[model samples]
Target: MQIVFVGGSTGQGGSPRLYRDELSGDFIVQGYLVTDPSDLAQMKIPDGESVVRVPRSLFDYLPKDDADGVA
Candidate 1:
Protein backbone atom coordinates (compact mmCIF):
# COMPACT_ATOMS: atom_id res chain seq x y z
CA MET A 1 0.00 0.00 0.00
CA GLN A 2 1.31 3.45 -0.91
CA ILE A 3 1.37 6.20 1.70
CA VAL A 4 1.72 9.98 1.39
CA PHE A 5 2.85 12.60 3.85
CA VAL A 6 0.03 14.87 4.98
CA GLY A 7 1.34 17.33 7.55
CA GLY A 8 3.28 17.71 10.79
CA SER A 9 3.57 20.06 13.70
CA THR A 10 6.72 22.13 14.03
CA GLY A 11 9.04 20.98 16.80
CA GLN A 12 12.63 20.18 17.56
CA GLY A 13 12.16 16.50 16.81
CA GLY A 14 9.40 17.22 14.27
CA SER A 15 6.96 14.53 15.33
CA PRO A 16 3.15 14.28 15.49
CA ARG A 17 2.54 14.09 11.81
CA LEU A 18 -0.37 12.90 9.63
CA TYR A 19 -0.19 10.60 6.66
CA ARG A 20 -2.65 9.29 4.10
CA ASP A 21 -2.98 5.90 2.53
CA GLU A 22 -2.71 6.45 -1.18
CA LEU A 23 -4.91 3.53 -2.07
CA SER A 24 -7.48 3.58 0.73
CA GLY A 25 -7.56 7.32 1.47
CA ASP A 26 -7.40 6.52 5.14
CA PHE A 27 -5.43 8.71 7.53
CA ILE A 28 -2.54 7.49 9.63
CA VAL A 29 -1.45 9.60 12.56
CA GLN A 30 1.96 9.65 14.21
CA GLY A 31 2.01 10.97 17.72
CA TYR A 32 2.80 10.22 21.33
CA LEU A 33 1.29 7.09 22.80
CA VAL A 34 -1.44 7.65 25.35
CA THR A 35 -0.51 5.30 28.14
CA ASP A 36 -1.85 7.25 31.11
CA PRO A 37 -4.12 5.04 33.18
CA SER A 38 -6.77 7.69 33.74
CA ASP A 39 -6.80 8.66 30.09
CA LEU A 40 -6.90 5.12 28.90
CA ALA A 41 -9.76 4.24 31.23
CA GLN A 42 -11.97 6.91 29.68
CA MET A 43 -12.04 5.25 26.30
CA LYS A 44 -13.20 1.82 25.19
CA ILE A 45 -10.09 0.74 23.36
CA PRO A 46 -10.41 -2.52 21.52
CA ASP A 47 -7.66 -5.03 21.06
CA GLY A 48 -4.96 -4.08 18.56
CA GLU A 49 -5.98 -0.42 18.83
CA SER A 50 -4.01 2.13 20.83
CA VAL A 51 -4.66 5.81 21.41
CA VAL A 52 -2.29 8.58 20.39
CA ARG A 53 -2.10 12.15 21.61
CA VAL A 54 -1.31 15.00 19.30
CA PRO A 55 -1.20 18.76 19.67
CA ARG A 56 -4.18 20.82 18.48
CA SER A 57 -1.87 22.76 16.21
CA LEU A 58 -1.39 19.73 14.01
CA PHE A 59 -4.83 20.23 12.49
CA ASP A 60 -3.79 23.59 11.13
CA TYR A 61 -1.66 21.85 8.53
CA LEU A 62 -4.45 19.65 7.26
CA PRO A 63 -5.65 20.47 3.81
CA LYS A 64 -9.01 22.16 3.46
CA ASP A 65 -9.74 20.36 0.19
CA ASP A 66 -8.52 17.29 -1.59
CA ALA A 67 -4.94 18.25 -2.40
CA ASP A 68 -3.42 14.90 -3.33
CA GLY A 69 -6.23 13.62 -5.55
CA VAL A 70 -6.88 10.80 -3.10
CA ALA A 71 -10.58 11.59 -2.80
Candidate 2:
Protein backbone atom coordinates (compact mmCIF):
# COMPACT_ATOMS: atom_id res chain seq x y z
CA MET A 1 0.00 0.00 0.00
CA GLN A 2 1.17 3.54 -0.68
CA ILE A 3 1.79 6.07 2.08
CA VAL A 4 2.15 9.80 2.32
CA PHE A 5 5.28 11.43 3.78
CA VAL A 6 4.87 15.15 4.42
CA GLY A 7 7.79 17.49 5.12
CA GLY A 8 8.51 21.17 5.40
CA SER A 9 10.79 23.59 3.63
CA THR A 10 14.09 24.90 5.03
CA GLY A 11 11.93 27.13 7.25
CA GLN A 12 9.34 29.90 6.94
CA GLY A 13 6.56 27.79 8.38
CA GLY A 14 6.05 25.56 5.38
CA SER A 15 5.81 21.86 4.83
CA PRO A 16 5.93 19.27 2.04
CA ARG A 17 2.92 17.09 1.46
CA LEU A 18 3.05 13.58 0.09
CA TYR A 19 0.07 11.59 -1.16
CA ARG A 20 -0.51 7.96 -0.34
CA ASP A 21 -3.47 6.34 -1.98
CA GLU A 22 -4.04 3.11 -3.87
CA LEU A 23 -6.16 3.74 -6.88
CA SER A 24 -6.21 0.07 -7.77
CA GLY A 25 -5.73 -1.31 -4.27
CA ASP A 26 -2.12 -2.03 -5.11
CA PHE A 27 -0.45 1.24 -4.19
CA ILE A 28 3.16 0.59 -3.33
CA VAL A 29 5.62 3.07 -1.83
CA GLN A 30 8.91 1.26 -2.21
CA GLY A 31 8.13 0.45 -5.81
CA TYR A 32 7.87 4.20 -6.53
CA LEU A 33 11.15 5.10 -4.91
CA VAL A 34 13.83 6.19 -7.38
CA THR A 35 17.46 6.43 -6.42
CA ASP A 36 19.85 8.64 -8.31
CA PRO A 37 23.31 8.80 -6.86
CA SER A 38 24.17 11.69 -9.16
CA ASP A 39 20.99 13.67 -8.37
CA LEU A 40 22.72 16.21 -6.14
CA ALA A 41 25.75 16.41 -8.39
CA GLN A 42 23.58 17.12 -11.41
CA MET A 43 21.45 19.65 -9.51
CA LYS A 44 24.57 21.37 -8.13
CA ILE A 45 23.26 20.98 -4.60
CA PRO A 46 24.79 19.47 -1.50
CA ASP A 47 26.08 15.98 -2.01
CA GLY A 48 25.53 14.85 1.55
CA GLU A 49 22.25 13.10 2.29
CA SER A 50 20.74 14.27 5.54
CA VAL A 51 17.78 13.19 7.65
CA VAL A 52 15.02 15.61 8.56
CA ARG A 53 12.98 15.32 11.70
CA VAL A 54 9.67 17.09 12.21
CA PRO A 55 7.43 17.54 15.21
CA ARG A 56 3.92 16.12 15.18
CA SER A 57 2.36 19.57 15.53
CA LEU A 58 4.15 20.88 12.46
CA PHE A 59 3.10 17.86 10.50
CA ASP A 60 -0.55 18.44 11.38
CA TYR A 61 -0.35 21.78 9.59
CA LEU A 62 1.08 20.38 6.40
CA PRO A 63 -0.91 21.26 3.30
CA LYS A 64 -2.72 18.60 1.30
CA ASP A 65 -3.26 19.07 -2.41
CA ASP A 66 -4.94 16.32 -4.39
CA ALA A 67 -4.10 17.83 -7.73
CA ASP A 68 -2.81 15.71 -10.58
CA GLY A 69 0.93 15.18 -10.84
CA VAL A 70 3.04 16.62 -13.60
CA ALA A 71 4.57 13.81 -15.53
Q: Which candidate gets the maximum TM-score versus the true structure?
A: 1
Model 1: ten consecutive residues of lowest lDDT? 62-71
- In the range 1-71, model 2's lDDT, one tens digit per residue, is 45544333335434333333535322212212224656433544445643333345544433445344311
- Could you tally the backbone clashes for each prediction? 0, 2
User: Would you give me the overall lDDT of model 2?
Assistant: 0.38
Cα deviation of 64, candidate 1, in Å: 0.9
Score each candidate by Cα lDDT: 0.81, 0.38
lDDT by residue for model 1 (1-71), tens: 68888888665546798888888877888899999999999999999999999999887766776776444
Considering every candidate listed, which one attains the maximal lDDT?
Answer: 1
Q: Which residue pairs of candidate 2 clash?
A: 7-16, 8-15
Show model 1 residue runs off by greater than 4 Å.
11-14, 66-71
Give me the runs in candidate 2 sitting further than 4 Å from their true place.
1-47, 65-71
TM-scores, all models, native as reference: 0.80, 0.24
lDDT of 2 at 22: 39
